[model samples]
Target: MAKSDSVTRSAVLHRDTRFVPKKAVGGKGSYIFLEDGTKFLDSTGGAAVSCLGHGHEEVSQAVINQINQISYCHTAFFGTEASEELARLLTESTGGKLSKLFVVSSGSEAVEAALKLARQYFLELPTPQPQRTRFIARKPSYHGVTLGALSVGGHMIRRQPFEPLLSSNTSHVSPCYPYRGKKAGESDADYVNRLAEELDGEFQRVGPDNVCAFIAEPVVGAALGAVAAVPGYFPAMKAICEKYGALFILDEVMSGMGRCGTLHVWEQEGIVPDLQTIGKGLGGGYAPVSGLLIGEKVVEVMDRGTGVFRHGQTYQGHPVACAAALAVQKIIQRDNLLENVRKMGAYLEERLRGCLGDHPNVGDIRGRGLFWGIEFVKDRESKEPFSPETGVAFQVQETGLDPSHGISLYASNGTVDCTKGDHVLLAPPYNVTKEEIDIIVDTAGRVIEAVFAKVNAA
Candidate 1:
């Protein structure tokens, strides 16, 4: 057995059965330090969670203050000040339409609450359609890992093992992936319309009246590597949901909170969801926090139908998490960080193009704001992905973490249709400097080239 494996086997059940991660001893700004004092630039923000990066004195101070006041409180009995203030700020920014905020400890919990709230909204309908039990989602999408979130997620590999336990009421259609899915002769408009048609067909097949909600990531995260939908896709989707009287749930857990250069990605797409799940950068990784932002349309239905939304968690609206998130958000707004995201995002894109635009194995480079993805293909013309068994992306990631490079990233295999391609994801903190951005892209380019060369030689 490997040393890491032996160590983990004696202590815990880690995600990878064969490997154990090194202990993270400390962190500052946009880098994390390992036990051996080797530091890695946190390019992926620990899966796009650390927006403010690590070691923010302000966020840390806020958490400390909240804990001193009251860390835990039974939401069943009394709501805390921090939770109230955070909800007020969120609702205010959302223009009051997103009035109710249901806080949770993690993205999955928020998603679970969102799903239950959706189901409960239907229950409150005076003459609710009994057949409204199905859900419409898109493939190459990820919501979360809990049962409810997993039910809505369309990631084939993640859902495969739990297929038996997952709800059969869910249906997945093609994502609005323009790079690979769009035909050579088709225009962007036509490609979008085709995807809309596919979604419509799925809804019809599932029986429009039976579909409760259509859940999607405004910009697909994790699964497709920051794959934003084709222009006009979301408007078309929202219209369809409206026509069918179905709710729309946008899972912005990874793409929202300024990661996509906006407070909410749907704002950029010119659409609003009936319910939204947000996390990751919500608390800037200072504390565990996630939330369900309910739209006025859904609120109205619930208000008219039933007086109460039936769902609650013990740790819902924890004071310390709220305080930390509140402080983090205030800093974002107070500092006008969105403007920086727009400026830095363009710079990052240009640097990436300059560095890796013509690499032989690089298939596509795409993303928005600070989130970016580099896909690799064996045959560029055919966009043929490397075999999954090769694990090319994982190797590149491991090489990037070498002491000489000292860059960390989000990497994955099976990007092509969830079982064939490799991709390296970069989601540096929003507060990252131009120099840091250059270092991240340059290091990533070098590491990717090295891995590609090795693979080709083999």
Candidate 2:
């Protein structure tokens, strides 16, 4: 209908080869419109990037205003007011523990910067703690595709192809996935202790003295279907990191900036990460932007020693990006959108539970705030997952976006591990209304039922 068939026939190597996306011509509120005037609710915010939703005039105007004054300036020669203000807002939001901001153009860049900063922190120590060389992260995790971030990731499927090129200094422990990893009768406290112990063991195996930092997602986004760490998990993990003299780095690229009902997911866990990566929602998809907030301890080490961080990007603090992100952050706070995130998030969870909680194929409904995931299973009693060969998650994603359904939901495979289970994620915008939540759940439910019905028939 949009006449993209000709473009599809061209040489563009898209992310997927099977289908070409309908051209998005415009958007309003929560829905995107195509050239043919077809409207589809953007439930997942384009992989959780559009936090302010689409067509935010204020964000656009802010970007324009900054560009009019100073479109771009090299970080080496000059600093922009927009960049300075953005840093101030982030520092204020985090209560001043985060004193430094290293801006980049994408989530992967932010992750890469965080990792480099973590390792560099040790290298620049007064005593030059050379033994602090190892990095520890959790399994079933995703940081990014760049070499450094990829080296630290635990998604086997994504890592397998590049295993030879990955760093040997990185090690992984189990994720805090209660549905798959928790024992049948185990208490939450016990489960958390078990995970902490596992993390400690990995540190010991790698020689605790050699560990530089421990990285994890406060609420895992793409890699684990929005799985959250259990209560007290971060506190325990933070304690272990302290024991080993290791810094705590949390990757909140897809879960930060009020998406998880808080400014930072670690706040809910009752612990703060020493270095945190934030993206996606920061610029609200207006411009590509991501940044790392360095904690006071790390700042103190740098301040006492080298007094200058070693890593930076050409676009480390782009004025336009900073301006757009500043506007998005201000608008969110000004409107008290986080409160709506909490209220609407509760409604979303309830709606998801009421709609799909009892389905035999629906294995789990879990997450916090607006970030929710619905895992699928082949056998509910045994908690057995469908074979990856079936591609159940992909089927659900495809059918859910059919023109007849006119809805979109995020789908993911390998929810159990890096290659085993399947689930679909729903991360609607923080400002989503109750009616919007209902529509998303209802439309997604129909798609799930249709897919499983065919699976059962076969």
Candidate 3:
């Protein structure tokens, strides 16, 4: 859609005000059709949410059937079977490590729930530490948009407009970004230790007794692209949290629920978090759903104390959403899609490197499972990023979205700090085939080439 002549007539506020966005009319399998008849092969799953892809009839029917059975009920009154069973499935998947789960309406709410739970867990202890009030997070990482979640988030650009509204108790540390933070001569183990010390230093600065939790994304999502941790990074961070008695949280809103091949990204890492947040793939875009998975420690404390979380959302566990998400998970397990994710994920890494590895502007290609990120730079040797003014990542994304190129990817910037780099992410559905992978890579390659050709000409 172009700049609208009657933009003021629109009542609904869209992300951008300059243009009227096009409408997607229908979808099936790996494709969605726009009202204007343009077909797009969704490459990044609309920010990695559509794991099962466009329209899986089973999921759709599940939602309809749930609505017919029972639509809404306050959590304070009754607990529905759908939400109860979905919660059980999630907890069992963790092998009872995370003994309980709380369902919410979106990733942001799920994160907000985690932050609140962490604070309450401390107060519920036998010897309550009322001084624990601060949170420590990592830079260039995103959790969610709610006030508490945003306060913990370190994405500067997103936080700029709402800084006054965000809490001041939260501080940030260096992310485990090996591409940028790792020194030229440093070993992986040394790098992990260095990051651990930075986090430890922050806890000391804030007064360890005053800290409530240390949170981070296992695989940093949109704000920094799909950047995973180094070999021992997670374990090292968890140790630092233990030293200061702060809860450890892993926000996997975009990297959990089989998005990264395993059910949870932390499973690949060597640690289990005290609290975890998951969404995006939970309902496979069929319904609005997300969750906060509570580990045994947090659950045991709450159980022995007030026995209330002190938080509730009217739609915290909507029946339709739970039903849709349950159906989505069942399909993935029944069809063995995670095995496919592992196989295709390796192929995707190989193909991404094969297609753009030699490009002068390609700086790094890093990821795990079906998730990947391609960092762009002006000089590969120096790893110098393109000017933020160029908006290189968005340019590539928009060019690919054109009817001719026909691919939709997720674009991200400020990878260097909160304002300096560019990268695009690719997170196709978990069940995506080898042939579909070829088309996505080929389209991305061509789009990159065309965009740079024009830039060079200018």
Candidate 4:
């Protein structure tokens, strides 16, 4: 709360209007300094956005350079080298598996644009698929908050308010959440087969060719709290999309850009999506940047037909944003941060398991690379999540915000279905040191223990 809780009548409406949050004056490396002179170690990097950490001189220089050269150029008029080079960097990173890039200012815009692009793609085909109007996504997933993205997103709490307004054409299936979704006797292979069959059934229910695309996150982010796909699950889903002639879309808005050890989470999953959305880490919080990576199939359609994508945004391909993202990507490559993510990700798992894995309330600890989550439960043996009224996850998160605990934790509720579960995410910067990992884990363990101690007493 710091000194902010005492204030009222803030002109700017915040996410939580009940209380004003502490004002963050500055940050560096893995820590943020508040106006109250408290220095909190940044563990989640503000929903896994600051992969390069806060206040990097190089990214600053890149943005400054681009501003000096030329800041904004509408894509409708002219193209800037900043956007062109950024696109080249993104596409080439895919090894030409994806051939085209469309940039935007945020993840929501990228997803909204991707949906429209998918629609346009079907329209421009050698044989147009005017009937391909629907989308299929997994439950407890989040793409973004924009109307179209909201329509595809399965986050119940987020979508509930706008349900009547959201597009009715989209539907949802079960995500590959092994901790809760798996049956008592189910093997990993059996669980995957079950999910695959479910997806295939949904495609059949909707009429195969009527679906424009099936979108999912490579690693489920805020909505499910860093839930990665089970082995063989993605390839199986892609096969269904292929059979239906529907595009496969991976929304890596929170998992890609080297957050999950590899440059792309699909690199580990062994299947390429027809469309991919990446952000959060793209500009490392230096500037607003998100993008759509288009596969060869759709690009071919656009190239042969209209030679244009039907979607456009005022801030698409923003020069300053592209420049910041370019520097962030280049720094990642030059510094060999992906290797650090792999090495540290393993150690992070080890540390978390050692410190908190056996906690009575800690039901599951899961994730890959630098992204991880800890799910809380009342009965560990039964995997029974605490009632949402308890606010177990956010209580632990709020405890950490105190200057005494001095660590940041990203909280998620409704993990079990949008109303019944709780978990917290820990996504540090790629270049985080082993020492920093020790501090983060140690502090987080203490914080979690402290909060749950109070819950038990109450």
As a TM-score, model 4 comes out at 0.98
Model 4 agreement with the true structure over 1-458: per-residue lDDT tens digits: 44366447587677777778888999999999988888989999998999999999999999999999998878899999988898898899998989999999899999998999999999998889899999999998999999999999999999999999999999999999988999999988899999999999999998888999999998998998888878899999999899888999999999999999998899999999999999999999999899999999889899999998877889999999999999999999999999999999999999999999889999999999999999999999988889999999889888999989888899989999799999999999999999999999999999999998999889
lDDT by candidate, in order shown: 0.87, 0.88, 0.91, 0.92
Instruction: Tell me model 2's lDDT, rounded to 2 decimals.
Output: 0.88
Regions more than 4 Å wrong, model 3: 1-9
Q: What is candidate 4's local distance difference test score?
A: 0.92
Colliding pairs, model 2: none
Error of 1 at 271 (Å): 1.0
lDDT of 2 at 194: 93
Which structure is stronger by lDDT: 2 or 4?
4
Worst 10 residues of 1 by lDDT: 1-10
Provide TM-scores for the models: 0.97, 0.97, 0.98, 0.98
lDDT of 1 by residue, 8-47 (tens): 3546676666677777889999999987677878988988
Q: Which one is best on lDDT?
A: 4
The list of candidate 2 runs beyond 4 A from truth reads 1-8
Model 4: runs farther than 4 Å from truth? 1-3
Q: 46-164, model 2: which lDDT tens digit per residue?
A: 88888878998999999999999999999989999999999999998889988888899898998888888888898888778887878999888999999889999998888899999
Question: What shift in Å separates residue 78 of candidate 1 from its native position after superposition?
Answer: 0.5
